[model samples]
Target: MKIICTKSNLAKGVSIVSKAVPSKTTMPILECILIDATTDVIKLTANDMELGIETRIEGEIIDRGIIALNAKIFSEIVRKLPDNEIVIETDMNNQTMITCEKAKFNIAAQSGEDFSYLPVIEKEDNIAVSEFTLKEVIRQTIFSIADNDTNKMMTGELFEIDENVLKVVSLDGHRISIRKIELSDSYGQRKVIVPGKTLQEISKIIGGEAEASVEISFTKNHIVFEFDQTLVVSRLIEGDYFKIDQMLSSDYETKVRINKRELLDCIDRATLLIKEGEKKPIIINIGDESMKLQIKSQIGSMDEEILITKEGKDLLIGFNPKFLIDALRVIDDEEVDLYFMNAKAPCFIKDEQQSYIYLILPVNFNAVA
Candidate 1:
């Protein structure tokens, strides 16, 4: 198989599919990138069983054949090659030659017939969303997913589609992040749990073009994302998601409306006095029209006050500063509303429309340093 591709196009295709290449795999074929030039377009594919990616590049296919090359070496070679056309040819002895203007390198290749390909998914149950919106949603919620595998469901996000509204939710034991988006067209109701790894990779690959759309299709156990010249297929996490609606409440005895940036910066500064891995809660005293934040740790102590519009009742609460920072960093609003039910109940940070909601469980101040 022989194909002549420009360095820029080939490098882009390789970089996009390389996300699926496994760092360590018992099967060597899983570490290679399959190049299929038998069709009109030059296709590159990489699959690590759980996730698979395929992208087409614009190039000239001189010979109709297929070969698999090591993804690491191939990507490095293409990236370092001169900014010109690159010729890749495979011979009968399973040897692949990469040539540029003056540089040439030969590497062993594997037959593409032995490579595993992405599963074929039916496009009947599908939804179209703007590339920009999809990327933004993932960025705003992926951070809250559990990093451990003790609870499999916590490592993934729930994708629920009800008519024209799409809701994405991710939660760890300590906090929950929810983002709801409105779609342009309505479709059948569907719900699935997508692995966090797949969404993270897709976010990096998407160009974030507000006008461009991404077609997403779901089956019983698989999900597919198609955008531009690339496609991503991932295995769905099987199980029922948590009933989050019951945990959300609109009742609050106290409410505070404060500048988002000011509160975030105050929490950020308080965290500096606390040491890593130390259980020091940021104690907040909410009064009539102001809130005071204080933190005491082994290293030192800090106290600050921020003016807020308060109503309902005055209260004292304690929370993990990291949780507050995480939710605040993702929010784009100039001011945010916080609802509290006594000092033990979880805090709710959101807007009036409820487009985004963050629930953070409070820490016990008596036990915290």
Candidate 2:
């Protein structure tokens, strides 16, 4: 294979496909990226069995062929190449040569036949979403996915699509995050559990183009994402997602409307005195038109008050500062409503439209210092 492409374009293509290359795998071919040169387009592909990524870059194809190169070394070399066009070729001896301006390097190449092919999804069942909106939805709920959980399904998010409305949900035992959006076009009804790691990588690839759209398709066991010049396929976790709607209740003994940033800042400051791994609870005493936040730890204590517009009965609740901070940080709203039923039930934080709902289980004050 012989191809010539600009340094920036080559680097970008390599970066996108490298996410699928496994850092440690028994199959050596899985660590290498397959570079295929056709008549006018140069394609790069990487697959780790479960997740696969393929992208094409516009380049001058001198020789139409294919070769596999070490992704780690190839990416580093392309990233540091001189600000000039890069020429890559594989000789008969199976050695890959890279040249850009004055720099040159030779590395052993592997046969592209050894690399596994990416899964191909039939496009009959597909949905379209704005790139910016999908990125935002993933960002808003991905954090709530359980990390290293024994129940593998909890480590992923639920993509529940009904007609034109799409709802994304993630929960980690302690809190549940749900974000719903209405799509411009409908793809009927579908539900799938997408791994959190896959969404994390997809979010990175999506640039800040709000108008650009992503085409998504789901099969029996895998989900496919296509946008721009890239394609991603990820295996879906098999299990029924928890019925989260029943858990989110509108019953509340107290409702307070407060500034999201102000509450976030107060909880963040209170956590300063708490040490790592310590289960410190930020006690919130909600009163009429105002609330006081306090945290007590072995190092010291912190207390602050923020004014709010309160209704119903007064309540005092304790919660993990990190949980509250996580929800508040992602919210783009200026004012938010916090609903509570005494101090035992979960607290709900959401906007007026209820487009995004965060239900956090309060910390048991009896167990904290």
Candidate 3:
């Protein structure tokens, strides 16, 4: 394979496809990116079996062929190159050579035949989603997905596409986050659990572009995203996502409306005093027109008070300070509507506009120090 590509263009394409490269993949071919030189375009592909990404860039293709080169080496070489067009070629011995202005490199590369073919989605149920809106949904929900891989479903973010309204949900058995956006288009209805890593890749590709919509497809066991020339494929988790409404509280013993920024700042300060791995529990005492926030850990303690509008009886609740911070961040309004069934049940935080709701399980202190 022989191809001439500009360093800047190659760098961008490599960066996008590198998201699918496996760090510890036993299959050497999976760690290497497939570089193909067609008549007018150069294609780069990387995959870790379950997820794959392919991106193409305009290049001067002297010969029509393909080769698989180590993604790590190829990316590093491109980064080090000066601002100039570079030529890459694969000889009969199966070694790949890279040459720029002064620097040159040759590395043993695997034949393109050894590289696995990227999967193709034969039929796609197309839907148009605003890239900006989609990116925010990913940011809010992806962070809440469980980092543990033991349970597949828990590691994925639940996506419910019902008609024109799209709902995104995520949880780690401790807290739950749900964000809903009502669109103006007729998208029909569907639900799928997309892997967190896949969503991260898609979000990275979508920048601050004025593109009206990003195309997406939900297949049986996989989800496909087509944004311009790049395509991302991710395998869907097989299982039912947690029922969000089931974890919500029906009644509230205490309710308060507090400034979201103040509460977030309090938690940020309190988390510092809490030791790592130690439950960073922050006590919230809600009363008439005010709320007291305090945290006590082995390292130190913190306390603060924020004015609020309280309508129910006063009650104290303990929660993971960090979880509350995440839930509060999704609310764009100045104040957040808080509700708790009791000290033991999970608390619900909603936007004053009643557009988004976040639920967090309360921490039970058998004995408060």
Per-residue error (Å), model 3, residue 128: 1.4
Give the per-residue lDDT of model 3 (tens digit) for 83-154: 899999989988888999988898999998889877778755767677888888887777778898878887
Alpha-carbon local distance difference test for all models: 0.96, 0.91, 0.83
Angstrom error at residue 193, model 3: 0.8
Ranking by lDDT: 1, 2, 3
Q: Is candidate 1 or candidate 3 better by lDDT?
A: 1
Q: How well is each residue in 1-369 modelled by candidate 2, as lDDT tens digits?
A: 789999988999999999999989998899999998854678999999989999999889988888999999999999888989999999887799999999999999899877898977776588888899999999999999999868798899999999898999999999999999998887678889999989999999988488898989899999999999999999999989999888989888899999888999889888889889999899999998899999999999888999999999988889999999999999998989999988999999987778999999998887875
Instruction: Give candidate 2's root-mean-square deviation (CA, Å).
Output: 1.0
Clashing pairs in 3: 163-188
TM of each candidate vs. truth: 0.98, 0.98, 0.95
Q: Can you write out model 1's per-residue Cα lDDT over 68-159, one digit (the tens) per residue?
A: 99999999999999999999999998799999999999999999999999988776689999999999999899999999999999999999
Candidate 2 error regions (>4 Å): none
Q: Which candidate is the best by lDDT?
A: 1
Cand. 1 TM to true fold? 0.98
